[model samples]
Target: MAETEPNPLLRYLVSDPDAFAHNLAKAFEQAGKAAAAYLKPRETGDTDFGSTDEITRITKTLAHVGEWWLADPARTIEAQKRLVGGWMDLMSSTLKRLSGEPFEPTIRPDPKDKRFQDSEWNDNAFFDFVKQFYLLTSRWAGDMVEEAGDLDSHTRAKADFYVRQILAALSPSNFLMTNPELLRETLTSSGENLVRGMKMFAEDIAAGGGDLKIRQSDYSKFRIGENLAMTPGKVIWQNDVCQIIQYAPTTETVRRRPLLIVPPWINKFYILDLNPEKSFIRWAVSQGLTVFVISWVNPDQRQAEKSFEHYMKEGILTAVEVVEKSTGERGVDTIGYCVGGTLLGVTLAWCAATGDDRIKSATLFTTQVDFTHAGELKVFVDEEQISSLENQMSLRGFLEGRSMSTAFNLLRSNDLIWPYFINNYLKGKEPFPFDLLYWNSDSTRMPAANHSYYLRNCYLENNLTRGRLELGGVKLDLGKVTVPIYNLAAREDHIAPALSVFEGSRYFGGPVQYVLAGSGHIAGVINPVGKPKYQYWTGGPPQGSFTDWLAAASETPGSWWPHWHAWLTDLAPEMVPARQPGGGVLEPIEDAPGSYVRAKA
Candidate 1:
């Protein structure tokens, strides 16, 4: 409308002339007050800190009016001059009246009270208070400076004026205002949002103070002993950064055999193998299947040479060898969660590249293979951001865990960083403790090579989906490997959107069962028990591709684990007798869940 030269007032408010006049009159009055305040200037001078002694006493002595020359008559003399310049910039900018005057309080200060009205025409105590306060403050500053140590402040002008300007900006009689709606959401009742808010605020203060500290804790209800595997029931191998445990056989285990879990390095693997009853690892173990899980070594700065390819070569592939060597099996069924699944996909690519076909079947949980759909994370993975990250990785040799966590938190401010910041930083309170919060704070590091390559190729370039991505110099052709693939996508995952997970299905060229699980990323993958209210969606081998399957399948709500179990069992080898093959001795460690307990610092 403005571009069209159509008067905005004529279009939206031509019919309300009376309202226009009244509002316009009020606006002019406020403008006049603001302009008056803005034009009021002040002088500037010394600060509370004393002048330099080296440039001071001699300078004052040099300023004698009686001595403009030296004893030689052709003497040299120097004069000192210091110049300063700045402009005033604060004032009330609410509204103005047609008379170019501020609104005078014609009404009582409060209708509910009787003693607050003024009796004269220029009776605005607000502006009067401002003028009076500025005068007194300026005088008091000068009067009090001599009592202070070797310094001068009252000698400075505009010092008190700057403070007054700030206070004026916040006055109800002034312009700036607060957002009511945003403030309300954080302070409402019927939920702990209020409590959560206070803690976040506290954390901000603690963080700002540069003393922010994070310590891990043990939250896992499940535990195992040094003789846990030898106990004839269940077993767990605990490490400084991970806990590995095997479960008892279930009815479903009879159909499924040699189930091994591969979890991501970003966090502990126990998320998938949460507990005996709900643990997917335990569920597989109990179902008459031999289960083994790989626990990743947490690398600090010293061990930063590990890369994504290295993880595949030494981590997953080695775990497969260990599992096979112990069971005397040529291959074992596998399940990968999140980046674990990402690593699994890369491993398959590596296998195909090397003509090594050892993996029989694979399942991916909330794992993304095609990076194009990584959503908001895209903002932080452009070429520039990647370059910045590369420089950062160059500095640290890898991306630190806290750095990744900070990036993840920023993706969803309300859900992660802000809610607590408002309560803790703004409101000044302590952070309330929660299991999820505790887990979220427990972070792990990534190898610099892995971090840089993953960010550049997968995220910035979206190379995996574009068919432009290569792993360890080998074209990662997900379609070349002909192994059965199962994918469980969380219905409401922010990190790994379900549809994005489904995109990887097109890269695989075998029987693919894409299941949409009914939870967020980790919870959905870790789901075991047939929860009553869960839901899922499934596609088929005949659906052509992931694209075709989505077009054909209908949505259903319930635990999709049953269908997954059936699908995995159909592809897995039948169970064999209990036997131990050529395996390393059970290295006796300290206690059940030792390292993780330490993590619970």
Candidate 2:
């Protein structure tokens, strides 16, 4: 057994336990002081927990809950009936299976659900019983919540989320005893797997965080710019905020209108250029389009003042200038993804308002200009949470990647968090070498000012969609963006839900072409023409509601990438001889996926 490197944060604390205890004590003290202040009277009177009004309030709450159940007697009765019926069905199914008689399951797991994909679960009576029991239990919990109709919506949602967490925590897959496969493995391995699992658990805890990075199986396989981001290109322009990369041409003739990609600063740019097989940039270049991507700087304390405006001027606008200079072309086709799309939308509106027509056509990939329904991520954007985040960011001058990653992983705990816990810690099995998972673990820090401003303005207030968002001393109006716009959304995206992404189609004052890709946030955008896994949908025009559009749309058999290229090429200028990399006045500064991207906060 080899010892791995300890986390820097925990290494110091582990070496000096007394210092760690002191720090922990100080934290508790501060917490106590804050709690005391909150509970204490303004005039310095001693705090009293058992007041008449407080007791009366508690009694009233209990009375209200009782009244709610009593008043909805029929609903409660119906809920009980459903639960009984479910149990009966489960029992009947189990008996039939035990008797070797064919029985149809009352509740079947979704075909697309990967969790219960094992054929053994369906083939074996015991595994099927476990799965059925789990499903029934989950349904009963949901029903319990539904029966409590008297609770406020917020309280109900919180309860539901917590219940999901509880259920996920208690999943049979997490334990060797309940999980038949793991139990078999334990017996087969002579408990060596369990021993290895224990070692892994201790190693994870000592590292300060239990969240694993690279899979144990792929510990030494992948590296940036080697197995990943292997595209041939050069950084034609670099600034304090970002580096602009001009990808080398693959085709003899290129479209005069170059494509400029602005990926979210929340992650690296290599997501679109991961490998030769899946690189969207390589595909675009192969399509006879000169492509360029913006590699955002991983900001630190010194770059704390970098605001939304700083991203526009130094990030998007700078890239535009560099692209134009390199190709000797006035207009460039722009693609903004996620946060980058949000930034690009603001820049386009700013450009339209200021009469600066740099962008020929706009393409937004899973980008949300309107954050009114920004999905589950919105839960952590309230004033209280924002204030707490601001306090932490103020201390460090930037939000750490780990904090951000935790929040994101919470969005899909069953898929992202618990499975890893089972695989890495409980089962002690190494994770498969997944390229996307590697990219997902690779995160970046957000500057205090920029992040706070974004959370408050875009998420909390949703000012961007309302035409109230002011950037660079200019109020942005998304409707002013009249260029041919294409909006791409993922059907199964959690971060930027497809419907939320669809809303952008209505904001653009142009010929809007909205395409719904298959898969979630990353896989949807990265879906190639070759992948037979998923399909896409494209509707008539952005005329009615998203649901209506979805209903009216035609399903495409493969990737939406080709469809996007067709729409872009239709709006683009005539083709010309390929432009040499770094052929313009702005000379090449470094290589593509530049030094800024490799920097950790």
Question: Could you tell me which residue pairs clash in candidate 2?
Answer: none
The alpha-carbon deviation from the true structure for residue 178 of candidate 2, after best TM-score superposition, in angstroms, is 1.3
Best by TM-score: 2
Mind giving the per-residue lDDT tens digits that candidate 2 earns over 1-601?
A: 9998764323112344455355445544544543444444433543223235434433454454446656777866766687788889989988987888988886877687666765656766667778878888888876676667669754455456656766887876677666666655555544556555555555544332332342334434678888889888999888889888999998889999888999999999899988888989888989999999999988888878899999999999988888888989889899999999998989999999999997988899999988766777875666666887787788768987767776777788878887777777556677788887777777799989889999999888999888789987888898888998888889999899988888767888878788898899988899876655678998766677888989989998878888888888888659999987777677788777779888864
Poorest 10 consecutive residues of model 2 by lDDT?
A: 8-17
Q: What does candidate 1's lDDT look like per residue over 1-601, in tens digits?
A: 3557554223222244455355445544544443333333211221111225423433332333214333224322211110000001112211232346664322223243211222211233433333333333333333322222322232221222223333332322211112222222323322233344334433333432222232222224223332122222223454323444343444532432466778887776655534444456655655567766666655666546666777777667776765665566767788888888888887887787688878888888888888757644554555545776676667657666666676666555434654444334333345564444555666667777777777776766767667676666788777776888888888779888877887777787676777877778866765656543567776565245556776677777666777777787777547665543223333333332334422321
Error of 2 at 251 (Å): 2.4
What residue runs in model 2 are displaced by over 4 Å at the alpha carbon?
1-133, 150-158, 206-219, 530-532
Q: Scored by CA lDDT, what does every candidate get?
A: 0.54, 0.77
TM-score of each: 0.60, 0.81
